[model samples]
Target: MSSDELTGASEKKGFSTRKAFIFAAIGSAVGLGNIWRFPYVAYEGGGGAFVIPYLVALLFAGIPLLFLDYAMGHRYRGSAPLAFRRVSRYGEWFGWWQVLITVVIGIYYPAIIAWAIRYTGFSIDKAWGDDPEKFLFGSFLQAAKTPGPTFDVVPGVLVPMIIVWTITLGVLAMGVQGGIGRTAVIFIPVLVIAFGALVVVALTLPGATTGLNALFTPEWGALGDPSVWVSAFGQIFFSLSVGFGIMITYASYVGRKTDLTGSGSVVAFSNSGFELFAGIGVFAVLGFLATNTGQPVGEVVADGIGLAFVAFPAILNEAPAGVLLGLLFFGSLVVAGLTSLISVVEVGISAIRDKTGVGRVAGTMILGLPMAVVSCVLLGTTGGVFVLDTMDNFINSFGILFVAALSMLALAWVWKRLPGLAEHVNAHSSIKLLGWWRWLVALVVPAVLLVMLVLELRKNLAEPYEGYPAELLGVFGWGIVIAIPFLAMLLSLLPWQRGVDLEDPGSDQLDHADRTDEGSLR
Candidate 1:
């Protein structure tokens, strides 16, 4: 039985078409990272030359993992946990690991969205006035002087967080097609237009060419650096929303007989394209800021929060027609973030629906309301800046990379499911494959992830992460990541509800581990 069958068959939900699935997947992929992360990562990695390693990672690591996820969720014809259960009873914990990672992300992800929503309004009035860093850290966030937990709610952050959750969970309650699919179809194009217009406006600024040159100038030596390659892979993996449960859950909604590989290819390219476009727009604005202020592009370039919140506001304060630029830029962030947040929340909701055999709306409320409340309580306080920063770093480094690598290694070697998955993809996909994909998933991807993991651990060990207090890092950083898998395991031990599907969806009802000898791994 499916989630559909677990309830009434007639009440089951999915994207109405492959096109809808593609849009939803793209919406998931083209997110805040594309807007704020890619530019600086690209410029730092090797400027124009970063494209080579990025493309290599995309073809080798990014798209391959995406197809691996599609095969798991679509072929097993279930939610991440349900599908992995079909793979092998032992494999269910891995799915829960992925789902829990999303739960962790879902808790804090909307706070950033809330910030963006508030900033969109701030754009109209040049709200940050003089010092954006001071304004953001002091006035808007009311950040504590040091890193520690606090419960004093910042009303500014809380209201917008409530608003963000209301819109997000509200859409989710309408079921997959009515809500997720439609929002993607509508929001993605609007995102393109909004950001595209921003790009045009950014390019028209006086120093736009200077920023483009800085971004496109090839530092040939960067290609030789091992870390550059790693950054390329990291950006692709993060920007594509692969490895995490987002792609897997979204792929589960795609209709049968759809060309899964073809869809993956489209999504992969569209995501890359959007980010590159974003890099242009972002760097272009940075260039204007640099030239206008008589600074080098390198001096002006920043990444992540610093780029989005700090530097961008400074540009808006000085740039020509600064108000319009602020609207387009911040509005784009709002639109982009909401789409990705929906998918992050969906992964946990889908798993809950599968576990309890609840209908979509009920399952959404069961999990969604609490997640919203926690987001408000934790991230809408003075200490939120400290906790959110630590959690995001620890989770992205230790949490996501750890689960992705463990799941891939387990599914490929222990469960011996790659051949079956490849067969499933080849059956339904227009793009056929040989055995190399199996080898890539089995060996190469995990190797890259583990290497990245080791590097992160070493760097964190070398110094306290971002100079936060040891106790804070221990609780919110190391402690939470340490807790996730143990929690997932305990959750797995709880029996799935009676009506949820537990049988294999493949043609023959055989344990995937038993199929290891099948035709040389397909």
Candidate 2:
């Protein structure tokens, strides 16, 4: 019997419309990474030349894998755990591994959002004042004197973190369509508009063209470097938000008739488009900073937290209407971060709901509240920034990439589901997946990911990441990475709760039943 039949058809939940799914999916894809990470990677990789490899990776690896994720979830009509369980009992463990990585992400992700919130207020008066780096590390984060573990909580960070949790949990409590969907509909448009305005303002700045030129100037020689191609692939993989369970979970809620290929393309391109837009705004501001400071753009340009908090704030200190510009920039971060946070939290929420048959409220409270508490307590501390940075590195490098590569291997080789999934995607999607696409997903994507995994592992084994103490990196970084898959396997051994089945819930039967029910209503 289908999960709908087993749990009662009335209980299944989904987005109210196709647009809701698209908006929410795009919201998940566009996050702080787009705003901060991509521009620097593009600049460093090969300037304008990076776009060549980025587009290639997107076509060969990113979109194909995205299609696989969407088809799996939409076909099974369940989140990652349940969706993979429908494939095979062992496959369920992989899904749980993804969930655990997302859980780790959930714990610290909000803390950064909380930082963005505090910075938003600071933007009002250029409060970071003079030495922006000192203000961020010393005044705001109150970063630990040493890299070793410490529990000193920064009140400035904790207070906003509470508010962040309250808002996220409240929205999630409203159920998928009413809460997540509605928020996406409202926030995405505002995010786009807000950033659009920032771009307009940025272009009018004196150094805008200089920044644009720096961004787009192609260094033809850089293309030949294998590392540059690897960087491009890595950027696309991370930027697209694949290999994590977010796409799979979001796709699970999509309507049966939704076009998987078309939707995946929209989400992928929308994410890339935003990255390009953000790069323009970011580099434009950087150009102004370099011009004013009598430094080159390369010296002023940075990425990750440094770019968002340090470099940008320093520029704002010198810009006209600096305070107003600050608000728009930080406000954009909060909106982008919140949307991604919702999706990350939803991965765990949907997994719990699938496993135990709990409603949204119960699931959100059970998982969300604890995560919020942990986020507040741990990230609230002085050493919190160090810890957050460590966790993020390990999770992305080992956690996400490992799960993604494993997933492709399982679907293509073990289950042999790729051909069928391609058929499912092509049935509804305007863009059809042909024979070669299967080889790309099966061979090309996994090979590239494996290379990335091996290279990262070799690097980490050689030395502690970023020169942090080995003990700290071992516990928070490598420890968590190693633990996820083992824990997932352990969890898989537990007997599934009653009403959840181990067998595939036949899609044909579910579709027929839905049609019959609709006919009766007519």
lDDT of each: 0.86, 0.85
For model 1, residues 1-522, the per-residue Cα lDDT tens digits are 443333232213577777889999999999999999999999999899999999999999999999998888777756678778888898888888888888888889888988998888999998998999999999999999888779989999999999999999999888788899999999999999999999999999999999999999999899999999999999988888877788777766655566999999999999999989999999999999999999999999999899989999999999887889999999999999999999989998888877776777887899899998888889999999889999999999989999899999999899898998898789768887569999999999999999999999999999999899999999989999999899989988998876545767663432221111011100
lDDT of 2 by residue, 1-522 (tens): 564553343223467677888899999989999999999998998789999998998888889888888988777767788779888877999889999998999999998999899898999878898999999998888888887557776789888999999999999888888889999999999999999989888888888888889999998889999888888899889888788888888887766668888989999999999999999999999989888888888988899999999999998888886887788899999999999999899999888877766677888999999999888877888988888999999999889998999899998999998887787777778899898889998999999999998888998888888899888898899899999999999877776657555565465544422211110100
**Which portions of model 1 show Cα errors greater than 4 Å?**
1-12, 507-522
For model 1, what is the C-alpha lDDT against the true structure? 0.86
Clashing pairs in 2: 152-381, 152-382, 153-381
* Sequence-dependent TM-score of model 2: 0.95
